[model samples]
Target: MFATSSPPPSGPWAGAARTEPQPRAPLRTDLLDTLMRLHREGVAARETRRLVPDAIEHRDLIRWEQRAARELRSMFDEVGWPGLDVVGEVGAEAAWWCVLLCDRLTAFQRDAHGLLQDAGERQAAPARHLAYLDDRLLMHHGEPQQFGTQHQLFADGCVEPYPVDNPALVAERRRSIGLPPTACRTAALRLLSLTRGPPLDDHR
Candidate 1:
């Protein structure tokens, strides 16, 4: 059902990643329960660590499990899980917040995966060579040809920031987000804004 690390009791959900599919009616329900428990436990651990600074010093593996389990929850939650709705005293907004948080966590999972791949490639490079790329940058330490390839890759990233605003690109992004095509693009710009070298605005 998800990726898991070896060595038992590192976390309560150690074998959860090995869960297999079963008949949709029974298995789906069981999966929903397992996922909910995993998500709750992960969040509880994270909150405890944040409140108690020594939590990680004594329990680094638990902290890692908490992070990984949280990611698994996010991946499943993005599917719009139907079987595990909370019968809450809390309002609908609370459920929505959970959904939003899960979505953000899923994004983090994707970003982390990309980062790890880049790190692996960099580590394999010869002494004087390196490469990396993302929404933010395409850094390299190699010959001109390798730098040129990186430049092309960077340019090909669909959502990478541009120095000069392209109204059409901005409009398309807004449309993807369900905003009106004609709405002010500045709002979308705010989301992609990155600070480098030095802060340019008083808002910093």
Candidate 2:
């Protein structure tokens, strides 16, 4: 389960944790490979499904997502959100991708926001990730989103922001987290995906 004799060296985010409060998270190489593997599986399922949306059944994609969610729940239950310190930057990113693609566990998904928010306070996780999760939860609950990071793609190949709570404040909130403004209209953090033709609620 271990990577090597010693832990991997930290990356550019070595000093990311707060100086006084919120101590660095200890590394857990045992789970690093597992988290990354799950992320790859999820990405692969999405790519293959996208290519033959209609021909393929959703079983493979759903299975991957369910597995990812289950693994993440186990990790979170044992050690809270795995941040850069715990898994290294790439592994931490892999963890986030797993969380983002998790559609089977709505309760765990909501709980993740709090954990990620706390990690963000410690400078252990990205604010943008939390922003995207928050928007997703809001949309899941049938409420307007905050950062407009969720999107809807139409049959005509046009992409639009999911219903946002306050148009006036969205740009400012997005900028605070280093996201592009509503006017800039960058690709959304989460989309219904191109021509997949499933209702957004289906995943929720």
Candidate 3:
């Protein structure tokens, strides 16, 4: 992801960067299925959170994400960024889901961002993915997001962007990345923590 490599697969900051890994010659169906499975689990968890927030505890999600982060870290060791060439379009999208939901692994997620950016440059991955990741990283850091992908959910069922950088350029930035105009996706979640007040947790 970075110049040559990013975090080691063992841990987020366990060791120094190893030499950059290359995509395997043949397609990696194993990794594809693995990533897709992780994506499905994440989707199911989020869906449950949407339907019954109480049923899905924050710790439950964290536990699942720890496993997911480890899986993606191993995949990163196998194929740098899981680009389309390595895992095909569907698998690549699935892989992105893993990266996105691993909020607990901020360092790992941050390292993976560089890999995604490299994949975007090679045209093997979608720029939109990079946009989402970048916004997420900024959100994690409590900084202004470049694109309006991250949001804050209010207790009143109102959603708003977490202060975007260059507000005037949001539309243009979204367009460049093949995203629609600053839409905060609420279909997957009508409202999280319906009873909570002002500082309600945001749906990632």
TM-score of each: 0.25, 0.72, 0.75
TM-score: model 1 vs. ground truth: 0.25
The lDDT for every candidate, in the order shown, is: 0.27, 0.59, 0.61
The lDDT-based order of candidates, best leading, equals: 3, 2, 1
lDDT of 1 by residue, 1-204 (tens): 001111111222211112211112223444445445544643443343221224353253244344444544564455332221221112111222232222223344344334334433433111111111221122211122211111111212222222213443644433332323232232222222111212111210
Query: Which window of ten consecutive residues has the lowest lDDT sum in model 3?
Result: 1-10
Over 4 Å off, model 3 = 1-26, 49-52, 155-157, 189-204
Query: Which residue pairs does candidate 1 place in steric collision?
Result: none
lDDT of 1 at 84: 18
- Top-scoring candidate (lDDT): 3
lDDT of 2 by residue, 1-204 (tens): 000000011321223222212334448888888887886776566554232333353566666666777788889988898886687666676776677556455566777778888887877776766777787667666688888766654433345567788789987887777665553222221122422223332332
Pairs clashing in candidate 3?
A: none
Best by TM-score: 3
Model 3 lDDT per residue over 116-181, tens place: 988878866666667768877776666888877665655444555568788999888766655556
lDDT for 1 in candidate 3 is 7
